[model samples]
Target chain A: MRLGAALRSELSKLFRQRGTYAGFVVVLALVGLLTWGSHYHQDRFKVANELGPDFVVAGKSITALFIARAAMDVAMVILMPVLVAIVVGGLVAGERQSGTLRTLLTRPVRRSTVLLSKLVAGCIYAVAVTLFLGLSSLALGYLVFGWGDLVLFRGGLAILGPQAGLLRLAEGYGLAAAAMCAVGVLALMLSVLFDNPLTAAGLTIAVLLVSGMIEFMPYFEQIRPYLFTTNLPMYRACLKASVDTASISISALYLLGYVSAMVLVALWVFSRRDVTC
Target chain B: MSASSVIETEGLTKHFGHIRAVDGLDLSVHAGAIFVHAGAIFGFLGPNGAGKSTTIRMLTGLLRPTGGEARVLGRPIRDRLRVGRSIGALVDEPAFYPYLTARQNLRLLASLSGGARAEEIQEALKLVGLDQDADRKLHTFSHGMRQRLGIAQALVPRPRLLILDEPASGLDPEGLAEVRDLLRRLSEEGMTIFLSSHLLGEVEQLCTDVGVISHGKLIAQGAVGGLLAGGGPAVRLRVDDARKALSVLADLPNVMAAATGDGSIEVGGERDSAQLNELLVRAGVRVYELRPAHRTLESFYLETMRAGKSNDRPDAEKAENDNDGSG
Candidate 1:
């Protein structure tokens, strides 16, 4: 019951801040711009290849499903994590900086309960952002380019019919949201460690960027599997002609592990901390 | 712990690395009639850096004591959630979300503590005289307004015990008067208030029980009246001839010191007023009035602090004073 009250309070505060809506606006604008750019470039390519079926690109249909899948790729990789980092990173550290955490903690609530409420709130926000990104991109893509079979360039090219493609898109969004939730929890852990929200968010994004760089380096290939960022792009597995259940399960498990470890550490530190400062 | 005590601590100590912020302090505050009057205001007094705030923090469970135990409302201090439910506190300065309005901020806190109704929030605002500006964002509030809003937030839960740390720190004279009146009203309504302040005059006027701490130790804690009757009971004798009366009182064994005041003799010692009057009459000095003179809490506090700074234990000094009176 106390957790529910804390969650409601947290969500109310989150919504009142302009930054929350600003994040949503940024996501929509970026996805819209990406959709327009893809449409314009696809038109140019079609005009350029109008006379030559011999030189045409094979198995690359520009459908609504394809556009949404492409948008999710960018959203999951960059936009989603950054947005979640800003929101979740500010959950604890920002309150501390402003001296509201002292007031909040003085209420008739346990420290662990407050931390859990924030984690739940962050996860809800992550899912909301993911759904918004998916639905908006899908609707905008349909308006611009009609829906059809999805042709994805994975494992030497794979294709899915329109109905199956929609289901895969939903599954892809779910996986991407799970990845974002892991990022949110990691950022929240950093938030509990630091007194400044900006530092927490900056460090979380820095870690992600550095980890992404390391994941692609041939010299660091051996360590790639251990990095949490390695599993973020696994949403692509949902777009395969034959979904890789084992690979998806592995990615989900990796995210869950990261979330559990970070949350446990966060709870431990926050519970033992002296809020007098 | 006594059954009537609302707060009790034994050797409560808090050390911050090398600095001992609060050291081996024992304190007890009784439930109703805190010292002299029912639901009276208890003031925790100390000079700056004297651990008054630190002690308040520990009692409120904001800081953990390193060496001892404390209980509030008959529960251990470590039971924060249970203890917190019965108490409302304003630690240091009031802090709220700058983007949220006063009402919204109170509502948010209320919700976290098991959901205070909207009417309760409004009532709290009215009590603090912030009802007219309840909708204004806190960033736009003056410091005094915010202080009042802080008090309002504390009141929203209708807590049985209210602990305030320098509640009058940022208030002007009018705001100070309003807070004093509000606190008195709350006390009349049967709410226990424990506040800490360096404002001696405010404490003297508003508090019934006071604890004075110096160098991280409680130098004195008692009824405000008892503490103010410093050294021992004395009487101011308004006599026809002040010098003559002083000369006569100087010869008496019970009179500790006697000096002429404004057309009166200010006598200090354990001599009874009746005996002093009889002596003045037998000595042919006409006594107009013989009234007990009480020392101000300010003078007592200053004396205690001075004695503490001179490497003299306050309790020993107080014991010496008590012995002087008995002898």
Candidate 2:
């Protein structure tokens, strides 16, 4: 009965968050315009500096492409957790705060079923949102910018093979999604632990923010390698000269550890909680 | 206990540190009977700390009793999940997602309960008289309507037993009447109803049997008419002439006292109405009313509350139990 009809109950609540829709629209507009403008700048410089009288430009036109690519990469990382905090944080706390938990628990379902169902729904939303970002980038990069060759970083600049690049993009998305999923679960668990949604969301975001700072510290780098927040950006490593999967794998394991712990705690608390509100 | 009994609780004791919300209590609710608990209405009742809510929560598998046992349909309280399919309870104020329409809320509850169909949700809505306003968001419902919707949601699955906590608290007079009729209809169809309330008059009218719990203990329990029939208080005998009936009863042997009211004589102690009636007729006094004149559950519950004593009955425990769900 946990995941029973209440799963849809949570789902409907998620869709009701006006911020989610707003976030989607904002992401699309910014990413689309950024990619197109980058694409425009790339072609204009090529036609002017190379095809123009001087004929100075060579193979790839270097006009704002790096900035656009970097912006896209950063946007991808920021999109997942930033846009999803409210949904994830509200999972249990929102219901508890609003007294819906009593309504939900009165039904005949296991507590774990309810938590798992909500986790699965959050995963679905995360996948969809991340994919939206990735696809929009691909659209701008190919259709508008013209898919001749993609510039790169790491050791030295070199163009990427689309087949290989696309795979790397997907892998990065997966790693990032898994990391965000853990964050979402952490927020949900906190939601269960706390009675206020604002408290849960605030604490969750604060944890990620503080951990990110510690991971960047000179001495904490080693410990940082174990943090899920640190590994969130590891997806970019897929495009680096020497791909080191060691950190990504470590991050995945750590994310899994946090997710399980949070889920277990949530069930333990909810099962015994009295409907006091 | 007869086969007509549906819910029986024995020595249902629950303690929280120094406070006992519910203490040594024994209760039996007969099948096809609407039983009410009224001691809880005027002031705090149940164990000082182990409240009756704790008891209901344990029965619903939401909490574990400190010391006690309860049975429904002869099934002991355990983790078997049998009650999930049969029991519907509103232990206290019920909550629902404010954004969801009443119909959506019921449908979802049905699906979660494992066997509730969409049609059953509709039936439940109709049963609670909520069909006309089923589509409204729960936030917009008045307190009374919210209470009705809560009832509708619980009944959606059509469980064998329905536990309502103050189900009519928020209803207006008309709404209360509707609920009274609805409960009667349900019980007529053989559904067991256990409702808790503070309205003695209403409970006395709606419930066939009544149980009084004070300080977490069931002080008195029985059929409405039976409990009212016996007493340790004044009895008023209405007859053609109060003076004649008083004189006939005054002549009875070992008579302690007698007082006359309009067309009646109030008697106390040594002689009962039957003995008093025999003396009246011998004295040539025409007697019409010889029944106990002032027996009511309302006054009975008040007496129990004033006494502060409770029942210490214990129920049989579940032989085997297994509750292994997420929460």
List the global CA lDDT of all models.
0.82, 0.65
Instruction: Give the residue spans of candidate 1 off by over 4 A.
Output: A43-60, A216-221, B29-38, B232-294, B312-327
Indicate the DockQ of the complex predicted as candidate 1.
0.52
With a 3 Å backbone cut-off (N, CA, C), the pairs that clash in candidate 1 are none
Q: Say which candidate scores most in DockQ.
A: 1
For candidate 2, lDDT tens digit of each residue in A156-224? 344555565556567766766666677778777787788888888888888888888897789886786
Best lDDT among the predictions, by candidate number: 1
Q: Can you give the DockQ of every candidate in the order shown?
A: 0.52, 0.36
Candidate 2 lDDT tens digits, B149-215: 8888879778777877778787889999998888888877777777777666678777766666554
> Per-candidate TM vs. native?
0.83, 0.76
